[model samples]
Target: MPASPSPLSSPPPSPITPNLGLVCITVGPEVRFRTITRTRYLSFPEEERAGVLHALYGDNIGRLAGAAAYCVAQGIRLYRMSAALFPMLDLEGDPTGQRVLESLSAELRAAGDAFTAAGIRVLVHPDQFIVLNSENPDVVRRAVYALSFYGLIMDMLGFSRSPWNTILLHGGKGGRAGELAAIIPTLPDAVRSRLCLENDERAFGPTELLPVCREVGVPLIFDAHHHVVREKLSSQDDPSVRHFVLAARATWTPPQWQVVHLSSGIDGPQDRRHTDLITAFPAAYHDVPWIEVEAKGKELALSDLKQRLKPTP
Candidate 1:
């Protein structure tokens, strides 16, 4: 395990230190990893679901645990873990997940311990298909199941039910923020405690999600690139964003880590598409605790941003 941070002597985060975050994989020589796809997973015979899921889930766990170690070594403090960690672990047809988790309890416990022990904050973003606010009853039901699964996994991995170990999801169906907020209390403690909402490129921006965030008592992760495109800003550093940043900060529980997603654009004029590397970071983020550098470059982009952010001697 990497070194753990000391107990806070003052306010939870006295210094304006935003730890750089890497999304999913490591690009350079240090590490790289992946998980089984649903299509490939289902291709296997139904009779083999037990062994197959064990292998796939086990492999994913191993990869994540390894990535945690890599983060500690690289001094990267935040990581957005892939949402596909468990595949059919939540499916009603496939109930072998509990057994698989039991079988790998030792590995799971150790990996979870390592992540916490390393003092590395871990989070996950479910795919776009999951819209907790969707009016479609079936869609909402499935979204609830998927989210509950994330909470369960976090618990199994020994993650704290706090914003630091978040299960991030976009606030889709933007206009119906109330419906989203109404569902929060009904959710199990696992999902309720760790769930966070983020502003998306078009549907939900800071203006749309802020009220829901406060109402639901969840943190709001301001995605800089998304906000730039959503609001037609000159750049992510637009002065206007400072207001949004401070407002978003107020939504978070405080001092744990106010997360923001950082990415560059592929097209000019604040395109919603992500590029290989980010051009700049919001000065407003300096006081935040985590900025997830989610670009095509992955960890490489994160490393580049860190280098550029380093103060001159």
Candidate 2:
């Protein structure tokens, strides 16, 4: 966000070093998109429901595949798909969105082929409410079910079950690691195989999450900006930052290149909000293969970061 306050940021070298990424949505050339709230979606008459869903659901699937073609045109190789790609899929009632997804099997396969053939790496992050560490059983159950649905989406896209096609989630803001640890293995294979935990700015930091990630057998993504805000660190090069980064990296293995996140603060170090462009990166990200650029500028931010990170002769 804005400009960096004199941090020693590293340049990216392809494959061995970080490949900058974009979050959901893009601007400049807007993609036609639609999403409905759970309340509004549930209000449709039973007779009108199927038709409404067919149009709405098919529109998103086309857009999802269309994004890959856009990336190929723009020379972008990394993308995180929209988290709500299949709306209301986790509902407990009859219209759980499964039939629609299955009905659109050919479209899903075509979308999968589009990404794979183009070599655009794909991943997803569940919405914030999908928390596993909640004290409420209902919330936890819903979270588990939601995660399974994410895995299903990845499968529909024909993505391999690996952290490379990760279903990322936060460890919750409550700081209840014990409660979260107890439920990791109970998750279905579709989820557990692709799952990754991230440290948010408020409660979970790499220090708080590393042990649990290690214990639960999942990788932890180092969010460089969040760690700076959470710990009130002066720079990204702090030795402790690298120490924890390596510790988190150790939990990951081959096939899934270790992932990290980079961003500058919206105002300064005190703000959790992301700004239009990222201004600095961390030396600790030296070996991270995937660096999701978390910024409000979307593809603009990602492209700018990559240009600045390019090594100059």
Candidate 3:
């Protein structure tokens, strides 16, 4: 029998402070309401229903930009826009995609400008599918090119795309660290600098992913929810979690900003789902500069965070 690797063998410690933040994802079509609905669901107050409605859909620039604006207005300095922008092109197909991309480019430019003017940082969150397995190389190329346009237009770097099932260690036909090392070097310096790697929710954690980042010289982004879920499943102790956070910090140089994924999870016997926004905030409130809450009622969920960060007498 072979000896199982001790989890402690992962990484050492470092100093970093976690800040408050949220992630924005468009939910549905905007609905107009003349009055407030006094129906309470979950922890959100009914009086704030209108705000919730607006955050989810009202004033949206399609889906991606709207979500970005909603989060920024709520004092969330960091926002993650979905990769749906690219797929929207592919789904619509052809010159339709060309038109859609043009329109999206304009929208992203405007949104990026608004965020920049307001001193907020916006990052385009790319899914692994577009980056790793698009059948058409042009699709992948265009996606990256389009994002680079948005990044340049907005003056922000986008999140890096790693294998989706990385949390599971499945390694299903996607680029691993060494593979990514080769591909990343091929991108233009501007594009490469904007790319950031994130820890997956299923298999890998900062401990597992940071070495890849260290080798490739790309910065790391941590999803605290992912780390917690991994811990609960493995029943690891606090020292282990602390060790991973430290290791992740080691991958970054000074004055480097890191984005963290924060969201509450529902612990069932079988698996954890990012249901609420309660658990993640407290655990990560002191570790990083930006935190993106990936919750169902993100805006309302953020209200909780605002209350927490308020100055006390």
Candidate 4:
């Protein structure tokens, strides 16, 4: 009988590769950059509003295109768009806003096309000021407006207002999951369709927010650092870590990469503040495709984490 083939005859298993990316901006390579909004333009003469709006939107769109190009070249497939990209959108429904959107439609479509061709995924996270569950009606309205603005941006990017280019928000106003649940149906379909809820340091954790996400038919973005601080789950091997990680992933539909935000703590009263670089990654995060580093160093931090994750020669 022929000798059994040696185990070494088989090719070594391929190394585990991660699909990783940075948040809104990039550094070092310095491809992604920002544009000034010039809110003061809104104060200019009404007759000049059209010109001002066009200029602002045009400049920002150019910068956005640059950002997309950077992602394509760097193999960074995920990007979180900045909330400030369209300052005029804050004045939603203004004739000027409509003009700006109309004027930039082609450019926006081109940028979106480039992104799609490069296989880059886009996401938007509204600022903390947006709180859907706030008791104040005005606050809630503003929050909804912000979501609408983000929805419009995605629409302009030639993207369907769907979870593919999702809009992420944090759970706010602790224990008010009922309020959020009630408000979800009332939001414009444009906003609700792309919206996702995330756990924050003060208000919600995976355990508390998961049910709300499921009830609203949205996905949850598990912030590992926030969960560790809020739940005090310090160990990387904590059973809860894997449990919640899997739970968050379950909220997303197939073909959508489960997104998680990563950050480290600094010296502070709470020690929960985000540091410039991630010093360590929780082992429980294994197999996660898209991890957005929320460190102050942005892309620099992501580079550091990628270096750490590389297999030793």
Candidate 5:
């Protein structure tokens, strides 16, 4: 035999070389974030909400601890907590409601502190109900009051709304954007710096949402699934999706990270449902720092993204 090739002729080149260009990493699944949104988890069976949280997050403290632990273990830089918990007042009539709010605020503060200490940022998203209800002046007053107390714990405030609501644009063409700008000023400077707007499943994609965000001086959370839904609903092609992403990029400023949502879609007779499936978008245009997978099988979806995103040195 000609000289046998050395078993390790060329030891694998160093595998840890860093890519000079932007890099995208999948943080984890989005449904995991929804653990706090008991109501949205399922519209019916009101009683199951607590059970679900218990099962997923263990008790409230357990949930916060679990979230903190997850971020630390996975090297995830950011995590989102559902706004459902923020609207603790919804349970106020009950005798325990006040205690619950205090506990929740404490938990949030602890969790936020833990995350920050671990070098991760926690972003809390507001529910659609809050914004729609905020349109009422009375509700606005109450929301502002409640936020004044609990807002201290969060690093970023996310607002996700339905398309119809955006169409109305509460104040003008830039509905929630305008509302956020007006209301954010009322928030303590600490909270205002953390505000962010998310794109919903409705017709309004980043293209429509970015203008409003720019006017208000906040960043945008581009939910990939929402863009997919908009593309399918509007019958647009790949170019449309690319356009939307580019538009969002234009609005982003430095030091204010970009958070994007990723998931799959199930095509039904009339519409497509956002499923937890990961796909590739050329890395040439966008380098997302955080991606939340909005799928039913959250962990499984996360694993899939990991495999797909493995470093290729």
Candidate 6:
């Protein structure tokens, strides 16, 4: 019989099995190399407003490109774009504002191309100012406007109505799920297409938000950490956690992997805050393909989690 091959001659045992699939680690728009500007129309001199706005757009586009490059280097496939991308967008009626929008649109197209080339998934979570179920009509109007603006940005990025490039939002105000369901039909086609609902830590948990999400025909974004903080629900052992995970998974149609958010609670009597690193993995969420790490440490936390999954020699 031929002598057994020496350990050095043996092929490096197939590299550790890759994780279920590509995980989306958030590299949000915060590259330290370039500075981003938040220019408002009234903040600059009347004669210089247009120039100032144009410069801001240039800075943002540069920063976005840098962020994308960073993601590619770090193996991060999912990123959340900044909500303050174009701060004074409401002034688009004026010639200067219109020019800024037009230029930004072109710049975004190029950035989108780079992201698509690298297979990056882009997401946008508008700020809390967006409350679809607010009792005030003005508030609702502003919320709708914000969604439309974000939708426009998505379109410019060449991201069609797909879960891969999603717009996440919390199910607004407790007890208003039905109202939210009702208003879904009234939203513009652009806003409704890319919208995704997420259960909140305090108000709407799966029990309250699932019905609304189903009614509106949008996928749900399950945040495991939020569930644990608010309801003591554990994705590892809680039956309801598994049940809701499947429920949320079902809402996603083909070509869209279920996206879950993972984070660890800070140590405290009633800890709900996200810590820098995840202390435990959601065993039930192992099957989910795309998990967005929301810890304060961001990409560094993801690296730690990946190490945990590596097999011991």
Clashing pairs in 5: 30-293, 169-175, 264-275, 264-277
- As a whole number from 0 to 100, the lDDT of residue 133 in candidate 6 is 91
Model 4 lDDT tens row, 115-234: 888888888888889999999999998888778777777887877667778888888889888998889878887788888889887888888899898888888888777877777665
How does model 2 score by TM-score? Answer: 0.92
- Candidate 4 regions exceeding 4 Å error are 1-16, 28-39, 235-237, 268-270
Clashing pairs in 4: none
Candidate 5 is scored at a TM of 0.63
Off by over 4 Å in 2: 1-17, 30-32
Judged by lDDT relative to the true structure, which candidate is superior, 2 or 6? 2
| lDDT by residue for model 5 (1-313), tens | 1121112112123333211110112334312332344355456364654444444432544455566676577655555554444333344333233444444555545655675577655555554444522457877765555454335434321222221001112122234555656665565654455556677666356766677668766666665556656555433224565566556655556523455555544452124464434333323224444455555444455555555455554
As for TM-score, the candidate ahead, 1 or 6, is 1
Q: Summing lDDT over every window of 10 consecutive residues in candidate 1, give the lowest-scoring window.
A: 1-10
* CA lDDT, every model vs. true structure: 0.78, 0.79, 0.48, 0.75, 0.47, 0.70
- Candidate 5 regions exceeding 4 Å error are 1-58, 85-110, 132-135, 142-150, 155-181, 188-190, 231-237, 268-272, 279-286, 311-313
Clashing pairs in 1: none
Task: Extract clashing residue pairs from model 6.
Answer: none
Q: Which regions in candidate 6 have their CA more than 4 angstroms from the true location? A: 1-41, 91-98, 233-236, 268-270
Using alpha carbons, what is the TM-score of model 1?
0.90
Residue 306 local lDDT, model 5: 52
Q: By lDDT, highest first, what's the ranking?
A: 2, 1, 4, 6, 3, 5
> What digit string (tens of lDDT, one per residue) describes model 1 on residues 1-313?
1122222112122255468888887666555555566687778887887888888778878888888889898898788887877777777677777678778988988888888898888898888888887989999898888788888888888999898798888888978888988987788899889988889887888888898888878989888778888888887668767788888888877745688777767666377677677666666666766788877777767766666665544
What lDDT tens digits, residue by residue, belong to model 6 across residues 252-278? 885246788866666721367766666
* Candidate that beats the other on lDDT, 1 or 5, i.e. the better one: 1
Per-residue C-alpha lDDT of model 3 across residues 102-193, encoded as one tens digit per residue? 44455545655665555565565654544532446776576556545434433322222321101111111234445545566566555566
Model 3 TM-score on a 0 to 1 scale = 0.63
Question: What's the lDDT for residue 58 in model 3?
Answer: 23
The deviation in Å at residue 161 for candidate 3 is 16
Best by TM-score: 2
> Judged by lDDT, which candidate is best?
2
